[model samples]
Target: MKLEPVIGLEIHVQLKTKSKMFCGCSNRGEFEAPNATICPVCTGQPGVLPVINKEAIKMGVLASLALNCKINEHSKFDRKHYFYPDLPKGYQISQFDLPVGEKGFLEIDVPTKEGIRTARVGITRLHMEEDAAKNTHSDDKTATLVDYNRGGTPLAEIVSEPDIKSPQEAKIFLQELRKIMRYLGVSDADMEKGQLRCDANISMREYVEGAAPDENWAIQLNPKTEIKNINSFRAVERALEYEIARQTKHWEETGSPNTVQATRGWDDTKGVTTEQRTKEGSSDYRYFPEPDLPPMELVEIRDKQKEMLPELPRARKYRFMDQYGFSMADAEILTDDPYKAEYTERALSELVSWLLSLPEIEGTETEIWDNYGEKMAKLYSGWFINKLGGIMAQNAIDIRILKITPENFAEFITLVYENKISGPNALKLLELMIGAGGDPSQLLDEHDLGAMKEDKDEMDKIIEKVINEHQVAVSDYKAGKQTAIMFLIGQVMKESKGKANPETAKEMLIEKLEK
Candidate 1:
């Protein structure tokens, strides 16, 4: 019998707040020495009261809004009773019934055999809680140590419904969620640094055999095995994929009746999951509302957080397509990050200003900009997203800290547009500008990087010489081989030491070769 896989995810994102959730300790514990950033409240010292961090709450609410969740007006923390070496309090302060947000949905695009398909995943809830401390195991297998520095860090635990149908979908869901968090400045969501964590619940059910023709069919689900400690997106997808195949094989071998629901941990290096222990139900936690903190009233800050929310990736994507006429792929790349998108827009605005100030103008500024804007936007998008993006990735550069100002970038694009520099030379100039700050024009002059022989008279001489030397290509062109003209243009550019403008060279080559 064929079976279908069911999967859901619980994601914990550490908020990028200044302090911990319930204590004054620094939340920036990723780089801190083990246990150095902890305080009495975080370490669970008796008689020390835990105070909630307001910034954490604000970030949680912002994340909820970004996820399209409904904000709960009154939400409070509960004590989750558990025993672990890392939990100094013997329990975690978390939300049980009334979480910060609920009843939300996230849409993801997945690739299939046919094409790209859009699916909506239901978000069950988004709750706030404190993170557990870090546990480290010595390589010698002699000791296990606990570091409380990560404890009390604020986390927004987002639970998604079992709507993801495949491992690919699960990966996309996490990627989109991470992108949203990064856009909101809520969290870095870097899995490598342990800022983002995920637990996946996966199960398989036999495809239903018979149902009424018009009735919606529902299959009975098998007991789910929850996989834990999946750090990265690739791990999440790989673990789930492995679990699905393993569970399916188990069902085939022993039947579903003998399969037991359990908790498992991914051995990333081993490429398999190992059983951790039996899965615990809600009652095992014995959750109780914390009497120390009162129910939070979020009405006052809800509107303020909404006002602070910037245009998210999805919305900005459509706007980029509508306003700039960018393709979906191009828009997606340009708007992947908030800062990159902002930089693109800023440079585009500066570019339009430069275009409007040009000497030739037969119409209103709006009309003029409209006529040339799409072409210019395409040019800017290509250079920024492809050329500059590659350079940044190669050099481990962050746009936020990059030396090239958007204004300078706009000037660089203007140079390319005006043919003051060839494409090859423009790339070289961009590299120099990124390494050291200077006016693009001044750099062009200082480095002698201007286009070579743009004057038709000089270009004609170069093209004539190329045509004379490349007799076979000239004969091919005269014999109606249109593509042969490119060969002549290549020779002209090579002779000019790559300073020759390609478009001008091509035109000159055509003029001389046709004759």
Candidate 2:
């Protein structure tokens, strides 16, 4: 029997707010000493009342808008009963049926051998909730420790429908979702820091070959295994892949597709999932409206948040491609970080202005862009993404802390575009500008790194000297060895200390050698 994996994800995003969801405790508990940020309300002391954090609600609404979720005009918090060492109150305050948002979807682009395939994963609901405290177990398994400081931290639980088809789709969905959250300025959504976490529910459904699951009436839903403790996006993909294989093997061995629903923990080290416990149903939680907090009227808040929504990642990516003539790959990278995207746009604008001011170029703004947009855009992306990005990575520098301003970056790119400096000299000038924060032109002059191509007479003399010194290479070129000219050009650049443009030297060397 042919089988397919049905997958859904429940993502919990910790909102970047100043205080806990139901109290005034500092929300920066992840950085503080354990239990330092806890207070009576968040720690669930008896006789203490809980006050909702308005800022957290605003952020939740903003995120929902970004996700294209329809906001619920009215919503309420419920007490989710559970017993755990990390739960100080013996219950969690979360949304039940009436969540903050619902019926949204996230679009992801999956690359295949054929081309880019776009998939829209449906979002079931996004609810407001409080986070559980951190649990630490001893190495010997003798004792456990709890840190209540993280308790009551504001969280947005985004539940997705079983729309994900494969493990790669799941990973891409999560990545796109994280980018949206970051673009909204609501949260960093850093998986390593525990701000954004995912629990995936996956099951295998038997299907006929070449038949759609929806069209096949014989297809039945198998019990799903909810995989938890997924720390990273890669782990989510790997864990789902492992589970699909394990379940497929079980079906073949037992000759039965029916299995008990369970919750499992992903062991990243062993690359397998271990059964944690049987999965609990909603009824098991005994969810009831919270008595301490009143129901919320979110219509006003939703309207206000809608007005505050910024351009999302997907929209910005498309805009970058359409406006700047950037390739899809380049646009994705440029728009992945909001700060980097802004920097790229500003630098491109400066480049356009500088190009228009050039004496040799004469055209309307649109005409000029239509003529040179793609070429200039490609040049800028190569330097920004490959060259400059590599340098920043080598120095362990974040784009936010980059010392090179967009204007200066544009000027440097202009120098390269106009062939004012050779490639090697351009690289050296860029490094200097990055280190000392000087103008590209000034750095070029100070370091004597200007391209030697502008001085035609001086370049001719250098080419003559290189031809005389490399008699063997000159003979090879004269004897129809086409690649020997490259060696002569290398000597010219070396003799000129990398100031000579290779293209100019190649032309001069070929002319001199042919003569």
lDDT of each: 0.87, 0.90
Which pairs of residues have clashing backbones in candidate 2? Answer: none
Residue-by-residue lDDT tens digits, candidate 2, 355-381: 899888889988898899989999999
Tens digits of lDDT, candidate 1, 1-515:
88878899999998989889998888888788888998889999999898888899999889888888999999999999999999999999999999989999999878779977889999999999999998999999899999888999999999998888889899999998988999999999999898889999998876655655223124555678999989888999999999988988988988763267799999999989999998898999999999888899987777789998988888888898887778878888888888888998898889878887888856776788679877887888888988998999999999999999999999999988888898888899999998997899999999889997547777777777887788998889889998888777778877776789898788767766555
Once fitted onto the true fold, the runs of candidate 2 whose alpha carbons sit more than 4 angstroms away are 212-219, 464-488, 510-515
Off by over 4 Å in 1: 112-116, 208-220, 359-370, 464-490, 507-515
Model 1 compared with the native: what TM-score? 0.91
**TM-score per candidate, in order?**
0.91, 0.95
